[model samples]
Target chain A: MDLDMVKYLAELGKLEFSDEELVKTANEMTDIIDLMDTVKEIDITYDALKDNHNAYLNDLREDVPAPSMETAKVLQNAVNTNNCFVVPKVVEQSLSKGVVIKWTYLQ
Target chain B: MDVSSMTIRDMRTALDERKISATELEGEYIANIKKYDDKLQSYITVTEELAMKQAEQAQKLIDDGKAMPLTGIPMAIKDNICTEGVKTTCASKMLENFVPVYNATVMEKLESQNIIMLGKTSMDEFAMGGSTQTSAFAKTKNPYDLNCVPGGSSGGSAAAVAGGLAPAALGSDTGGSIRQPSAFCGVTGIKPTYSRVSRYGLVAFASSLDQIGPIAKNSYDCAMILNAICGYDPHDGTSAKVNVPDFTEKLGQSVKGVKIALPKEFFGEGIDSEIKSAVLKAADEYKAMGAEIIECEMPSLKYAVPAYYLLACAEAASNLSRYDGIKYGHRTANAGSYEELIIKSRSEGFGDEVKRRILLGNYALSSGYYDAYYRKALALRQLIREEYAAIFEKCDVILTPTTPTVAYTPEMTSDPVQMYQADICTVTVNIAGLPAVSTTCGYNANGMPIGMSVIGKKFDEATVLQVSDAFEQGFTPVMPKL
Candidate 1:
């Protein structure tokens, strides 16, 4: 793993690290990934995947609508306004096109 | 009464015979916690008021002659498990003040039985690390030696039980969390077969691998707790619909003719010679008791650690994604956009170990690396399970060391991979979704505990408990001197 990859993963994981910490994280992740690489030594054969279906498929409960926590209770832990979670702007108008775009940054 | 040495059975007898009131028992435990917790730092939240209230209710039940087996029994809970009004922090800043609106299914069952909750215990942040040192709260010390750490992510539960702060405690195991800590803390703990216990409101770390079980001073206590907590619930979709048995039913049963398999891989390189010999001695003890000991091979054992890390981290990455600033948990005060808010909040909330896992999990599941890492881990997981199934075909149970070595100081290993290697002995049981119990079989030169594991077939906790209880009968567990 390299700094670029670490940065990408951090971005994907919705986390941030300072430049120094990113390098340290990259080194640590490299060691961990090396450990993960040992799984490649497993000689995968067709027999392994033969019965790879969900073993608990029959155990799943019926997907019926059921009573859940009240809206007020559900939102009680959040920063809410009128029972809805309040959040920073997820969309912003593009200055050039005057069209809304998803907000994003690399941190 | 010596609350420090009393098991649930002893407490039950005393509570029922009027030798000690439930309130008195609760007060004794609280006093012990107050006396020793400053040095041990095992608990994150001590629910004294809640315990007193539950003790009062338990006394009323006993007075009315309706006391259940676990009634009036005080126990500690891992912080990961939801307790309706108490903060279930998972020992992370992320959920530091997050209180659940409802209780976990296990909590509900215990509550109905009138069990007293002494408090929430600390653990590795998000149950991500093997050492309790990763907890954002206090680092729980090994009761045997304060310089050493109590093995974790369930370290607090195990420490509390071993320290006599609580008789027994509930712990969740994902890749040796419960058993490792129990072993390190010189107590007994079980990680039941996957889905044998409900996982509803467990604050999912690895959805497929996580299972909640008990840690206690002995196997009988663990069995009693398991009896109350193990059962199907509509709330947890993965909970097995199989019949729940009296886990303590097989206690004192003969181990004669029982086939115990010792996989050669577990005793090989990286294991401490003392731990290996102690576990082998345990097997010999079983042999003397008329049980058949058979040496076996599990080639897939070499891949278990890697595969477990890949699978568990991937699941953790997905599960922990819910901690964004929007819905609940910590939110950053200075973010200009939603994305920035999530990144900042998570960056600020999680500890180093948790962040490392998230990053690694994403790396494993990333678009180009999925097949090489995540998918291969899944295949290896299947292979590992099949290997266990094959061994079980000829064996009643598998015996192995719970950890490669005894508990060590926090400064023992700075390399993360070295720490991961310590779990090599216990992770395979979780990978196979089997029930295994860790009991102290011997002690090291420094008086640190060495644990041996007895793993049973899926949902066969009765036999597992039977074997563990049989071992405990001949062995004496040394308590840490407070």
Candidate 2:
């Protein structure tokens, strides 16, 4: 993996690192990916997929809503909240266009 | 009685005979923690106030003649398992101040029995790494030797039990987390069959592979705790509906004619000679006790480590995505945009190992690499599972060393690959979603504990516990010189 690819993947994962750390991370990831090359030798058969699918499918429960944590307690761990989680400004006025909104709060 | 040294059975006898009150038992453990925990760094949050309250309530229950086996027993919980109103940090700065409003299903079950919880123990950040060194908090040192690490991400739970700070503790295992630490700390730990234990309130690391199990001084104690915590729950979608058996009932049964397999593939080149000899010697002990030992081969398991890393990291990437700045956990103070805020929060909150796994996972799942890595790994995992099934058809259980080597000084695992290799001997059990227990066999020349694992079929914790308990009957654990 290239340094730039590491940066792109980091951005996709919503993580940040210094440029030096990214370079180091890229190298480490390259080593890990290389190690994973061992799996390529195995024949591709869907036996596990079949077993996994069957095991997980039949275990579903009825979708009834059960009692949940109280709203005050749920919000207790929130860093920025006023009966709801608070996030940074996601909407800004575009210089060449009408006011743009990036997100809207759920009611 | 020294409550810290007493097993759950011993403590129960004391409590029954009025030799010790529940409050007195809790106080003894707290005193032990105060005397020894700073040197070991095993706990993240010690809940003395809550423990005392619970102990008082437990005394009322005992006096009322309503005590369960687990009632009034003080135990530590891995920081990853949620506790209502108490901090569950997962040893990460991300959840450094986060507290849950509800208990995990297991925690609720333990509470119903009036078990006294001493504290939240340390672990790898978000249960990501093999060693506790990756914890954003303190690294838990091995009780046997302070310079060496208690293997992790369940190191704190293992260290606490082995150090006699807590009689028993709870830990979640994903790729040998609980077993490895227990082996290193000279305690017994069980990683039950996948879906055997509910994962509802466990902070998810690898959703498919994680199972919560008990770390205790012996397999019987492990079975006792398993009885209290094991059962199906509607809260965890993956929990199996299979009837929960009385695990302790299988104890003391004859091992005569039991077919035990020694997979030659597991005892390969990388394994330390001492561990191999000790584990083989343990197999011989089983043979002397009338169990038939046979050698078997499972070649596909060679790919387990790589396949496990690929699958675990892939799941981790998806599961850990929930930890953005908006909800619970740490949030960044300043950011120009919403994306920037999330990125900055994650970067600042997660430890280096957690970030590395996320990066690897994202790379594996990236557009061009998905089939080459993730899909291939899944197929390999299936092949490995099938191999286990084929082997189990002729064998009641498989025996192997819990880890290739005994506890190493924490610094020896600085390189990622070196740390990953430590899990090679143990990851196959999790990959196959099988039940296995790591119990003390003997110590190496350095005096660090060596553990042998007895693996049984899916949800067949009875056989696994029986074999482990049988071994414990003839074996003496090497207690760390505290």
Candidate 3:
């Protein structure tokens, strides 16, 4: 991996790497990839795209919200309750399983 | 009895015998916190008033012969856990003032035991860094050597315990966060089975791998804290329903005939001589106790770091997307556009290391390269788990150094790879979701501590503690008196 590759990767990862960090990451990736390449020589048969060993892995379903989180309470945590996502909020968990438990146990 | 070094078992005896009051113990710790926390930077918030109130309540209960185990015993927690009404920053500017309205399940468990909470300690921002240097607040110094770092993101928890500021502390382990710092600080730390403790209240840092565990002066104390804090919480979907052992029950049991595997990879070249010797010395002691010792090897051990970074970063990116500065954390005022709002919020909220990880993780989990990096790492993770399961079948526990090296000075290794290498000895357990511990086994000539890791099968904390305690007796090397 070169500096350009590192910079591109950092960008994709959402990281803003410093100029110094760019060099360091490039060097490390170069070293690691070099070693991996050497190791792969014994096992490097380039399988075609879909025909590869892991191509048929299960595709998980997108999680759908089902009666979770109350709107009023959820919005309470929003800094701009007037915004699309803002509203009044309460601490989520009930005290039964929270800070009140000790006192409840004591009582 | 000095509560700082005393295990929970002994502390309980004193409490029950009426030789010590819970109030007195809480006072002692509060005083210690006041005296020692400045240079140490171990705590972000100290709940002295609340702690005292809890202590007083426990004293009343004890007078009424109704006090429970851990009642009024003060313990510090890593700041990532929500503490209802208390600021629960994950050591990030983004949740700096976010007072959680709810208590995390582990906190609830401790509260149910009437455990007095000392306060929340510092951590690597979002529990991202190994040295705690990435915290938005301040770096937590290694209690043993102020110039050096305590291994992190649980550095503050370890420092709190090692500095005698608190009898015990809590830390989270994603990839050796708890155990690594405990090793450097010469404190006993346990990263319990994944889901062994609930994650409901902990600010997420790689959800699948994150586990909340205890840090203390000894394994037995760790077990007691585990007994109090471990159990299923309905709030956490992943909480384990395993039977909670009366952990103290087996503290005195001999570990004779316990089969231990010394993985060849952990002890080979590239290991610091001091760390290697300390681990070997601990193994020798385990041998004297009639435990069976055998050599084991995981050829795929070298792949752990690559796999861990890819997986950890991928999850981190998704988990951190919630902190866009709009909901919680640091935010810039009057950004002209939403894009600017988000950019400014993130840049202002996260530290450099956190931003770097977010980027790395995002890339791995991104659309085009997911199959090449993230999926491969997961596949390799399964291979590693199978290797551990097979190794466990041959041995009762796996032994190795907790970290390849001791605590390094701040910025000792600016190269990320050098820092990542420190975790090589620790990450396989996280990938496998098995229980592991790092206990002070010996010390180097410089008096720096060396920790040897004891890994056990899934939910097999009992055996892990047994072997660690047995080994601890004969491998007794004290901390350099820092």
Identify the leading candidate in terms of lDDT.
Answer: 1
Tell me the tens digit of each residue's lDDT in model 1 across B383-431: 8888998999999999999999999999975789988878899898988
**Pairs of residues clashing in candidate 1:** none
Model 2 per-residue lDDT tens digits across residues B197-264: 99989999998899999999998899999999999898888898889988899999989899999999
Which residue runs does candidate 3 get wrong by more than 4 Å? A1-78, A82-107, B475-482
Cα displacement (angstroms), candidate 1, residue A27, comes to 0.8
Model 1 ranges with Cα > 4 A deviation? A45-54, A63-66, A80-82, A93-107
Better of 1 and 2 by DockQ: 2
True contacts kept of each: 0.76, 0.76, 0.16
The candidate, 1 or 3, that scores higher on TM-score is 1
What docking grade does candidate 3 earn? incorrect
Question: Each prediction's DockQ?
Answer: 0.57, 0.67, 0.12
DockQ of 1: 0.57
Q: Per TM-score, what order, best first?
A: 2, 1, 3
Higher-scoring candidate on TM-score, 2 or 3: 2
RMSD (Cα, Å) of model 1 = 3.2
Pick the TM-score winner. 2
